[model samples]
Target: MGIVRIGQTEITYDLRRSSTASERRITVTPGHVEVVALTSDDEAEIDAFLTRKRQWLFNALRELETTTAKRAVVLRFMTGSKIPYRGRMARLTVHRHGGPHIEISYRNGFLVDLPSWVGEEDQDAVVSSEIKLWLKRRVRRDVLEIASSYGRRFGLKPRSIRVADMKTGWGACGPAGSILINWTLVFAPKAVLEYVVVHELAHLSVRSHGPDFWMYMAKLMPDFARSKGWLDQNQGSMNADLFTSTRPIIDAT
Candidate 1:
C-alpha cells in the first residue's frame, strides 16, 4: 500500500483495490519501483520475501535510480538536443505546423533542419515513429533483397520476416523458420543494420551461434567487426530511447 522501512531498507507497495489474482510477485525495473501482487492471498509470503531481500531491494532501487538518470539524459538528447549522426552530433531544429513532415538533411557538413512540426516534448515519439516506419519499409525491402541474393548464393531461403522491440538481442532465427529482428536496429548505421540482416538470414541454415555461424556471417560480411562495434557503442542509447513511446509516426513501410 505504501513504503515501509525494515531496518535501513524502504519498500513500497500498493494495496489491492481491484486485484484478481492470489500470488505475490516482485519486479524491479528501471521504469517502475514497486512490489506487485500476482495473487492477493500470498501477501504474507511477499512480506517474508521482502524481508529476505531487503538489502537486494535497496541496491536494486539505487541501481534503478542510476538507470533512470541515464534514461533522462538520453531523453533529453532525443528531445530537442543535438545528437550524433554517423560521426557528427548536430543540433536539432524543431519546427511545428509546417506540413507534418520530418527529415534529416545535411547543411554545412552538419545534419540539420529536422521538421519542426512536432513539439520538443514529442521528439522521441516522433523520431521513433518516423524511424520505425522508415525501418519497416527499409528492412522489409532490404531483407527481401538481401535474403533473395543470399538465398541464391547459399542455397537457403527464409520463411518469413518479423520485427520486434527485443531488449536483449538484435536478431534471432528459430529452427522453425521464424525470424525476429529488433525494431531498434533501425536506428543503427546502414552497414550495421545490413550485417544484422545477413547474420539472421545466415541462421536459416545454421541455427546456432557457433563456429559455423561465425563462418557464415564472415562469408557474408567480412567487415562485420565494425558493425558489432557500432552496436556495442550505441545499443544503450537505442534501447533507452525505444521505451519512451508517447506518439505514433506514420509507418513509412
Candidate 2:
C-alpha cells in the first residue's frame, strides 16, 4: 500500500505490478484505491499520474466517505432489531430452547430458534449464520423462479443460475450463458430484482451494454428505466444490511 498526498487529502492506494503491458491503470473503490501498472513503470511516473488526477480522485474519495457514513449502522442480531427482507423491514425474534437444532423461519416476521446450550456471546454468530442460510434458500427459491420466468419470457435459456455473496455487482452473466446473482439482492424490491435478472438474461443475446443492448431491454421490459432508476437511487441502502462493514460478514465460504 502506498500513500499519495493531493492538496489536503491523503489517498492510500494498493500498487500491483502486472506483466501484461507498460501502462498504468487506476481503479477507485469505496474503501481504497488500486493502481495496476507494469513492473517496468517507475514509481515517480505513477505518483505524477495520481497527482494529475487529483480532482477526480478527490471526488471519488468524497463519495467513498459518504458511502462509509451511510454504512455505519451495524446489524444487531437481537429481538426487536429490524432486518431488511424483500424490501421490507422485518423485526427479528430470537428464541432459545432445549434442542440441538437451530431453525429459522419467517412468518409474521423473522424467527430464529436456537439450542438452549448456546450462550449470549454465540447468539450473534448463530443468528448471522442462520440469516445467511435463510437468504441463500430464499435466493434459490425466489430469485431462480423469477429469473426462470423472465428467461422464458425472453426465450433465453441459460446453462445455470447460481446465487452467491457478490459485493461489487448484483449479478453477472458469464461468457458460457450462466448467471450468478448476489443473494443480497433478495432484499431489494421485486422490480429491482426483476431488472437485474432481465438484464443478465438479455446479456444472453447482447453481450455488451451498448445502445443495442438497452434497446433490447426496452423491448423486453418497457419500464426497465424506472427499475434501474430505483436501484441507482437506493442501491446503498439495499446493500447496507450486508456491506456496511469494512470487512463484510458474508464470504465465499
Candidate 3:
C-alpha cells in the first residue's frame, strides 16, 4: 500500500498484483483505493498509474463524502438500530424508566436505561450523549491496555495515550511519544483496534512508514494488512451506526 497527496487529502491505496489483467485499473471505495496491475509491473509503474488517476481519485473521494452524508442518518437513536461495536453487531434496546439513572449495559445486545424524567424530545440527544461518553471511557481504557501490552513486547513505552474525536484516520502517534486513538474505534472490532494501537506504537520505533516500519508491523502482526484493509473498507458505515444508532424499549420493571 502507498499514500499520495493530491491536495489536502491523502489517498491511501493498496497495489494488488493481477495475473490475467491486461491493463492497470483503479478502484475507489469510501476511504480506500486499490490499484490492480500485472504482477510484472514494478513499483515505479504502479506509482505512474496512480499519478495518472490523481484527479479522478480526488473526485471519487469528494463523491464519497456526499454519498456518506446522504446516508448519514441510516441508523438513529430508535429501537432495533443495529449497533456495530467491538467487532460485533448488536441491537440497541432502549428501556424507558429502566432505572433511576442512565445506565449502559451489554448482554447479547446493548441495554440502555432512559430515566422517566427525561422528556421524549430529549430522548435521542440524551441517549446519544450517554453512549458517546461510554464509548470514550471504554476506548481510553482499552487503548492504554493495548498500547502497554504491545509496548512491552516491543520494549517501547508511549508517554501517554488518549481517546479523542478525529476527522480522519483511526489513531495518531504524536511527536512526543504520545498516542491519540480515535474514540470511534469503539465501533470497530477488537482486532482492528489492536491493529491501530500497534500501528501507533510502531511509530515510536520508526517515525515513517518505510520498509523498516512495515517489517516491524509484519513481525508484530502477521495479518496486519487484513485489519488495515478492513478499516479502510469500512471507514464510513461503522461510524454512521455509532453516532446515529437508533435505540429500543426494554421493560424497566
2 or 3, which is superior by TM-score? 3
Task: Please give the distance, in angstroms, between residue 201's alpha carbon in candidate 3 and its true position after superposition.
Answer: 0.2
TM-score of 1: 0.52
Residue-pair clashes per candidate: 11, 0, 10
Better of 1 and 3 by lDDT: 3
Off by over 4 Å in 2: 1-70, 240-253
The lDDT for every candidate, in the order shown, is: 0.60, 0.76, 0.77
Q: Candidate 2, 141: how far from true, in Å? A: 1.8
lDDT of 1 by residue, 108-207 (tens): 3222334665665456555655544554565566666766777787776777878766778888888787777776655567677777878888887777
For all predicted structures, in order, the TM-scores are: 0.52, 0.65, 0.65
lDDT tens string, model 3, 138-162?
8788888888788777788889888
TM-score for candidate 2: 0.65
When 1 and 2 are scored with lDDT, the better candidate is 2
> Quick one: best TM-score, which candidate?
3
- Per residue, candidate 2 scores C-alpha lDDT tens digits across 72-186 of 3434577886777777788889998898989989997899988888886466667877786787788678878887787677688999999887878899999999999887777
Superposed model 1: Cα runs more than 4 Å off: 1-68, 72-80, 83-91, 97-141, 240-253
Positional deviation of residue 120's Cα in model 2 after best superposition, in angstroms: 1.4
